[model samples]
Target chain A: MIEEFFLRALIAGVGVAAVAGPLGCFVVWRRMAYFGATLAHGALLGIALGLLIDVDPVFGIAASSVLIALIVTGLQRQGAIGGDTLLGILAHAGLALGLVALAFMSVRIDLMAYLFGDVLAVTWSDILWIYLGGTAVLATLALIWNTLLAITLNEELARAEGIDTARIQLVFMLILAVVIAIAMKIVGVLLIVSLLIIPAAAARPFARTPEQMAALAAAAGALSAAAGLFASLQWDTPAGPSIVAAATAIFALSFTFSGTLGKRAA
Target chain B: MALDKRSAGTGLLVEAKGLTVRFGASSALDGVDLTVSSGEIVSLIGPNGAGKTTLVRAVAGLVEASAGTLWRQPDLRIGYVPQRLSIDRVMPLTVRRLLSLAGRSSGAEIVSALAEVDAAALLKHAIHDLSGGEFQRVMLARALLRKPHLLLLDEPLQGVDLGGQLALYDLIGRLRRRHAMGVLLVSHDLHIVMAATDRVVCLNHHVCCSGAPESVRHHPEYTALFGAEAARRLAVYTHAHDHAHDLAGNPVAAADTNHADNEPEHLS
Candidate 1:
């Protein structure tokens, strides 16, 4: 099974896509694509710290991303700096720090693998991490689905209905951190937000409801993973970028079909 | 009206005492007291920055009072229709989905709730696709789905045309009659709702005047808060309706005729 590297990559990539699809809907709804990018960029710092402390890189990524999410949440409330500017500072700072740390490391490191993903290099243990982490994120999202949707619609309305909006927001941020941590190998830090956003955006025009949109996003993402994997094998293209390219193509196709449906509905 | 007052014993849904809300340094709402009773329509009227929204939010428990005591019925269920909820065009949410936000509602329940607000045909429509009047109906439908004891409507007539506004007011009046739900509405258009509202509270950071619509229209506090011309116009509108009655459930024929005679002069 270890010999079938491409098969392993496909499985890992599909699993990540499934989780990223629904989570991505919130990203699109809340306009948190840049926030997703910041968390993904911080994963590199986690990897560096993991190496320095002799811990698993996955754990390192999860911890660092969560820390960064908390910091962003805290800073956003202070209102001293705008949200996008804050995210830009954190994104670049985390990426630069991670790169510097990697440079100073005594052991040889393949920086390209972390930056653009090394799906072909994934081991069976990596599959376990991806599925386990992905399942946890999915389960939490399901448990809070209604509450999250309510909050997304209007925070004040949700609060008036007795929902703990602030706590739900915090939990949502944590789930995003976990997803970024586990999805690193499938799409890498640079392309992680793309995977989280593109499929959801593509599925939007065709969907009539939130649940339908989520299901369609997952299907679109999985299809992209399978198609992209095949394309990479045929063209020798990078797997992560190829997956994103396939997603973009699907999005373009949706526009053609969705316009008529939108017209009919109108 | 007497029947409602008797049935809703003590007639209290929400009571706020000396409610004050401060944002950093400035006070959005200061030392305001409000009472909403079941089977009653209480309209909060104010100009921009008058803390009408703050008062509504505070009563809905969306915003905590910096210094005040707020009381509610032990089993109070509030249905809130916000003044403006900007639904992002990107998200795909149908009217049915929005109604199911609190929890899973049966298809039949969804249909009936939509019908309650005269939006049964819009159940399948995407939220972003609906026109402003249609959207307000959907919002009202969603609020009704909660089977609330109290309905908090913030400028529910906004974006609705004159005809639609009249129909909505009729529907709201029907809702009060059917469910006996307490309604606390924030309205900018005093002319439209003056006849429907049982009480009118004029606010400008504090309660300028609050009483029966007829009295509030004449209160110096209300006239001072809103100009004398505006008060005269409100009084004219209030008396223009043949169906209008005083708070004591009596038809004020003399008052109506007096105002009807004065209406042209005020308009001129």
Candidate 2:
């Protein structure tokens, strides 16, 4: 017999995985893994803000991640500093600020739970947020899939084709913020990007088409979540890192299996 | 196929007057006046860092004109082939998928556009596997798929071999005659320009000289700006090149008929 809490954790993790899979494909394609990490790191400040205001950390995370993403977008026009430098500054600064703010709070905060996810402790309400938020993300992703892919191929080309590339990129970043907001409970702050890029990357060699890659990536993510959950149950490991480990293992397997495919993703 | 856009009076596709673009304190382009009319072929040539590309980008609305006014036909459809399109090696894409980057294109349209560029067979091939010349042809097909009113080619002949360059230039002339498309081409190489090109605008931060291809090459400013060797390379290589060719880049037909009629009178 399955425990209700484990069932809930399984459902929530799987929901987040399904959504992150296709989105991760874009993350990998645009080589925005650092950007993904930067946003996830910013989610901690959001959790602290949520605690300060007596609001749900999920909503706080959504607000902070979106704010950080927009700020980065706007400041990218400032020329001198490279994008990675900007992202690194924002990422570490946000994480440290969250830690400092959390330290000042009166309520007993389980730092471990927020830093690395306490997936085994997931509640039914968290599952609700996961599915509902994941649905919206998947729908929005489908609508902008082609346009996003075009811009990812070449921003200048897409702009010349009359696409408002900046607007599309902004929209994409917002979508990513929502993903971070909902997936935070599943994989915590630091491992969110691991859940994103690894599964998508693992699915790369096997896919002949982009749509195929997205579907395969989603499949890979779901299995990693399930397998990771099982391993956590068996070994009493932390659920967030276990999920990421499972994802990495799958990537290793894919790399080994696809070695004969001749072409490798750079 | 020049389906009478000129008669419909699309007139000027782009008109830029005294355009200036600056990056930080340095200027990329300065005081450049240029225009492209419907059914016109204009070539932009200059030395490296001459802002040839900046002018093209400004006209294409890719860059903001910092100090001057630029005008374009309302709702202008532009087919732009950038100088370099380095496909990300990780992205999974095929030639057939490339043509629809602007928007959705039907299979027939895709096939036809690829055929026009002599790259129809590359439809199923992964873009990562393509050679440089093959990639250029596919990019051209992608540009054509837009059925643009104004076409922008930034150094389109860079990777093509000499024989293929002659053939591709021939194809560009045919496109102008058939579609009446306005072409704004940027060329770094002085090796060749299309026989049908109406204007050659020489640039070195400013409009050094501008006129018909023949007169521009002979202008005193043109000679002074570009020394003897540069001007000598600007000499037009006019030859009949309409014959069909196999994939090996060899002419399949020896029939050279009236294709030469399109060249300047001095060339014949």
Candidate 3:
């Protein structure tokens, strides 16, 4: 039944994991974990802004994260400061701004819900949003997979091949922003990057190619979602953190088995 | 310098006139005129920071020329092997998958491409796991997969051993003969590429001198750019085996055989 909040939560979590798995591969490959964190941290500010302006929180998070991504991109081009330092500034500034703004809000916003997602409280509409957004992200990612891989391997070579690397980079950043916004509800803003990074990292040792890695990552993510949900139900733990823990466990297991598998294959 | 109308008539793969590339306030490449015709090998030689890499990048369309006109044959396919390719460890990419990036190719074609550079054994190897020489061979294989009209090789010999360098040069010569593709090679030492290249373009932010390997070795501009001592070394290397007696007691050009003897110390 739509009224069964746990069912709605499970569906939403799985949908988000399925998309995050492949997209997370790019994040890990490009070493954009900090970038992902920066965007996720900025989403909290978006939530506060959404509350102030009486707009949907998802829309607010997407707007603020995209804005931060663009700002990061522009500052990187200026070459005034190094990338990690720039991300650190934006990441902390965003989190600090969000906390301060929340303090000033007249409405008693349930800050805990946004900080660590309340997946068990999800509604049927949340499931619809997850599936629709997830599909769009996955399809676009599929279309640009080769180009993204090419760019990631060597920007100069990709440019020489006449691939529009700049356009692809813009598209990638926007997709990351959207994913972080949608994923905020599943793992919360604090742990959103774990959803994007862990499963992909876990999938690496077993995969011989990029496509294999992406597919395996998606499977790992889905498995984590299902297992984390069940674990949360059994242990009365927070769903988002439980999911991340399950993904971590899988990652650790991968290290143990992958070596033997690699030896056998060799 | 006047453009060679003869090469233009025959078919030029790439032509750049006054190609200048500026990075921020400084000029990386300045007022360079160059051309690569079908089936020709053009070696670009320059000292470090002399814009040799920048020139190759400009021709490959990786960098835009700040003030120049560059032309390529319409629909020309270019296979470029960069001086260095650093694959992230996290990215799971095998040699076969890398070759597929140019477009889809049959498994046989992939094998043949790898075999062309004597790297067939690396078909399933992860790119990150490859040693420097192995990585270069795989990169060459990736470029060969395109069956390109032109090949831009930027310091393809950087990390290769002496024997591997000779093999790569032989492979390049074979590719030129077999595919008739124009090749723009960048190297630090002109002596090594002298035998294989049809013309050597010496660069120091601009064209110092360019002509047949022998002439460029003697060109005053080249002498000035590289100094008289280096020029003498290059000339000796070029003329060292110009006349040789084969088993039949007939004079033969042993340039190819003598290539190993003149292996530049820098390369070693």
Candidate 4:
């Protein structure tokens, strides 16, 4: 029974790593790390909505993430408030609202499952959603790869070259929304940003171009997920935070070595 | 904003009518009007605060024209090479990769564009490691790949030294001849602009003056902006900025302007 649960957790971890790798590249490139955290925090409200409405948690998370992304993008375009201030408001508001909604629910809720994730309790159906959602996000990212990269380099230059930046930006935000929704299930709402940022940051020292960085980040993410699974099995640590901790360790090591090698190369 | 007949029949490719741009309360460009015709290399010359960058930004569509209309070709694609193409220096990118971001271009086309700028050899090198001059050449190469009808260059000759500037001028001249693109180049190098551009348009919160490089050189307003010596130097070169030929032997550049002599010292 224990081995079966472990096997399921391993599969889910692998799926999460694959999705996090390329998505993290944009997070690092656009300097959207804080924004990722803000959205992930908003995912908790998504969880609350799922419970309140009796819908799938993933769908609720995606809807909430999309809402947050649109609001942030719109507010930024209007230049009404500073980006960080707005993000802080939305981040805390989502968390607070979700907690309030959880209180009003009649049934006993597994708070730890949503906060820290339950890889050991993973079902085959959950794995299916992970793969299906992961494929959709990755495929969309592949289709608009060049266009997204162009906008990342310089929006004005991209527009001058006839690439519609507004549409591309909307697509990117949507993809990010989906990634956040799926990632929430694996890493839990609070720690979701780790899966998106840590792997990419770890791969930073090794990559030369945006494409290379993304590939390397995904590879690093998978390795960390596997390592974190082992650590969880040995000590019975929570799977979600364990994976994040493993990624953090890898990042520290990479940082030390990359700094030394980077200095020498220069 | 009225344009004379000579300006109207000059085959104008781009017309900026009463272009006004403001950043907060300060007016960067105030009711500025200018026109660029086909087969001419025009220079937008002005002092540091003369709205040259603002006008260029408005033309490139980087900034809105606040309260004016820009009339150009319906498909008026522009190639922009900014004052400094500063990348994160840490990011690894090749010249080919940089060009690829601008638009899709065949390997042969890329080589041809690079050859135009004499930067064919630096194609494989990391762009961040390139020198300022080589970087500018690469930028020019990338811009040429778009086959732009209007090429807007912002202070192309700023940081580059004498040797680099001369090579860039040669490349610019070749691009102009081959593409016949309307080039609106901005430069603070008064001495170089006097020699290289066909016409100089003096801009300072407005179109102070615009005429042939030689005529603009003799205009009192032009001399007032940059001493008599600098104005004469502008008239000498034939868009090449190389050595002065027969028509370039004028020594008026050596004659110090009375107004230029008494101005307060301003270091760049």
All candidates: TM-score of chain A: 0.95, 0.96, 0.94, 0.95
Better of 2 and 3 by lDDT: 3
Enumerate residue pairs that collide in model 2: B1-B178, B2-B178, B2-B179
User: Which 10-residue span in candidate 2 chain B carries the lowest summed lDDT?
Assistant: B259-268
Q: Give lDDT tens digits, candidate 4, residues A20-59.
A: 8888888877889889888888888988899799998777
Measured against the native two-chain assembly using Cα atoms, what DockQ does each of the candidate structures obtain, in the order listed?
A: 0.64, 0.50, 0.58, 0.39
Q: Go through the candidates in order and give each one's C-alpha lDDT.
A: 0.81, 0.80, 0.81, 0.76
State how far residue A28 of model 2 sits from its true place (Å): 1.3
- Model 1, B1-268: lDDT tens per residue? 0112234534699999999998998888878899998888888875577789999898888788899888988878888988788788788888888887855567788888888888899988788888878988888878877778899999987887765666677788888878888999987653334456788786667675566656445556556765654454333223233332354322345443433221123321
Name the 10 consecutive residues with the lowest summed lDDT in model 1 chain A: A257-266
Misplaced by over 4 Å in model 2 are: A260-266, B1-10, B214-268
Residue pairs in clash, model 3: none
Off by more than 4 A, model 1: A1-3, A260-266, B1-9, B190-192, B215-268
For model 4 chain A, give the 10-residue run with minimal summed lDDT.
A257-266
Instruction: Give the alpha carbon lDDT tens digit for every residue of B1-268 in model 3.
Output: 1111223224799999999999998888878999999889898875577789988888888788899899989877888999877787778888888888866678888888888788899988887778777888888778877778889999987877755665667778887877778999996575545356788886767775576766445466656765654443333114233444444333445545543222344321
Give DockQ: model 2: 0.50
- For candidate 2, write residues B1-268 as lDDT tens digits: 1222334334888999899999887778877899999889899875577789989888888999899889998988888888887877667788887776656788888888888888889999988888767887888788777778888999988877765665677677777666778999986554245556788786666765566655335445545764544444344433333453344322355345533222234331
